[model samples]
Target: MSRRAAASILVLTVVVATAIGACSTAPLDVGSSDTSPTSVPLPDGPRTARLPSADPIPVSPTPTPQLPVTVTTADNRRVTITDVSRIVALDRYGTYGTAVFALGLGRNLVGRDIATKFPAAASIPVVTTGGTDANAEAIIALRPTVVLTDASLPSANVLTGQLTAAGIPVVTGSAGRTVAGTDAQLRAVATALGIPAAGDALVARTDSQIAAARAMVPRDADRPRIAFVYARGTGLLILGGPGSGADSLIDTVGGQDAGTAAGLTDAFTSLTSEGLIKSRPDVLLMMTDGLASVGGVDGLEKIPGVSETPAGRDRRIIDMDDGELLSFGARTGDVAVALARTLFGRP
Candidate 1:
């Protein structure tokens, strides 16, 4: 109550507060947040004291990533497509199916033209009874996500419109005689399938092989005169123009077509056996595929005036696969070189 007594009490209170603050300043035990009395390792008594063990970090299931399918076109167009699980290939060029096989996407095809000969397409459904006579009803019924169509068809306009209306993407291409153009067409197909690099690689490989075959032929030659005799029954011999596949093959193997003299700019005139004998070809070529149909060389010779011709007399007729030799798609150089060997002993 007195001033001196109160001052002594305040000093006592300050000393007590300071002492309490100093006691609170002691360092904390980081392992335990609890303010309980620290315990030294004591031997287990009635109730055994056990340390906690970490539950094996519940191993999380790993996630797997899926790959997206993409295709790149020749014109540098990129298209991202999905659910491309089914495909149908319909066209005059059976080589298109061969080209698809070359791209390594043959397994994706569910249907093909009747003429498809590639091993992969053997088990696949056939959409037609004949080569170019594919039925649109069957093709549409297959319900493929994509259809590879040959631009070589005269009816491509009608076919494309129908396919588009049915919600199918129709990819078009021309089977080129030259490797350069053929590869470009393959690239377009690859792009549509979302595997551009694969298409490019296939084209490169095929072109290289064809180039190797062509390289085997020596340019130095007398340019032997050659003639492609398309024997329709007896007297019907359909010759090609300068730009035809037959023309390309003749040039590649160092020979000239017998009909080149006629100067028929397009596919033309049925050369009679009389005319063929008058023209006198150094080498006469006919497609091997048609040999059975043409009834072989004896059959060819028996064609009224063929035996009198120099080609038949000398036994110089060469036969090869018509599609492989003439399609000018993948095997142009192969057939050309084969013909070259028959005439000039090369490749």
Candidate 2:
């Protein structure tokens, strides 16, 4: 069998394993009794609701198209594009597609990765499944003139080679999870789509929004020490230390990462019950699916050592959609602000 087939089988195996594990665990009714905090009080004052960062940035009335453009990708590969039509972005975080939409070229998207669920882009035909696995045949069927992706795509080189052989320009951008990394990704996608100026404008707007959100965080507020736990029923992964998108999000919202404080250095690691208890996180951050998989806050508390932590005892958990939580793309600033509001109350 080909490497592509092998990779697909491997991913399928992992997905099946996770599903089996979930089946063995007790199911939580989707509409079961709610234990999570329903309404966090807003700060005492009238404050304007900030616009969502995902909103399109206003560009020139007539966007100047730069064709036959050559640009260097995050992988240091130089690729030239002759056409800006029929684009596909297969990045796991769907940042490229978001950048394209932000650049006012959403209509040109012929296909999207599974993670691209934002407005306009959400309706595009998905060319990948199981998060980042590219369906080569499906992608080819889309007849995308250019493809933008990240290094995380399974069998990236093989996929890119296949597309290149078929006369499509495949450009890979940085998958950095930090703010600066996000900026670089936006610029890279823009350059690949031949709209460097639009990228610059979007980045500036994003940075400004981030700054505004940061300003809303109360200086005197009690910033919670937080831990982001990735759970799929019995399968649990702890997002710890620096470099992880969870760390970036926690920092952006003015919260401390308890995992980092406990000296866990990798992007993700299995946590011991004792280690988790000792970390002493005041709040737990989780993806919505992960939270549901463990039967919500009640089920999460049943995990060893979790109930002992201040977070579990108080049931202080913040959950976001798995994709949006980590995408770190155009909506990152808005996400940070939303998370901040949840933690310290809205302003």
Stretches of candidate 1 exceeding 4 Å from the true structure: 1-84, 175-180
Kindly state the number of residue pairs that clash in model 1.
2
- Candidate 1 lDDT, 1-347, residue by residue in tens: 22222212111101000000001123456785755433222111111111111110101122111224444422232334454567787555455565555556566678876545544466988775534545677878988887776644446667766877777666665534443466676666666666666665656655554554455444333455566666545544444445445666676555666667545454334556566666566666666544445677777767755667566666667765443445444333344445544554421
Candidate with best lDDT: 2
Evaluate all candidate structures by whole-model CA lDDT and list the values in order.
Answer: 0.52, 0.67
Give TM-scores for every candidate, taking all chains together and pairing residue i with residue i: 0.68, 0.80
Poorest lDDT segment (10 consecutive residues) of candidate 1: 13-22
- Model 1's alpha-carbon lDDT is 0.52
Off by over 4 Å in 2: 1-62, 220-223
Report model 2's TM-score to 2 decimal places.
0.80
Q: Give the alpha carbon lDDT tens digit for every residue of 1-347 in model 2.
A: 23233223221111000000001123336888743423222233211223344344444334566888898876787899989888888776666776677678877889987767756666789888776678878888998889988766778888988888898888977756676576777777777777888878777777766675566555534556789777767565454556556788788767778888878767666667887887898878877777788887778888898889887777777777655666676666656666666666543
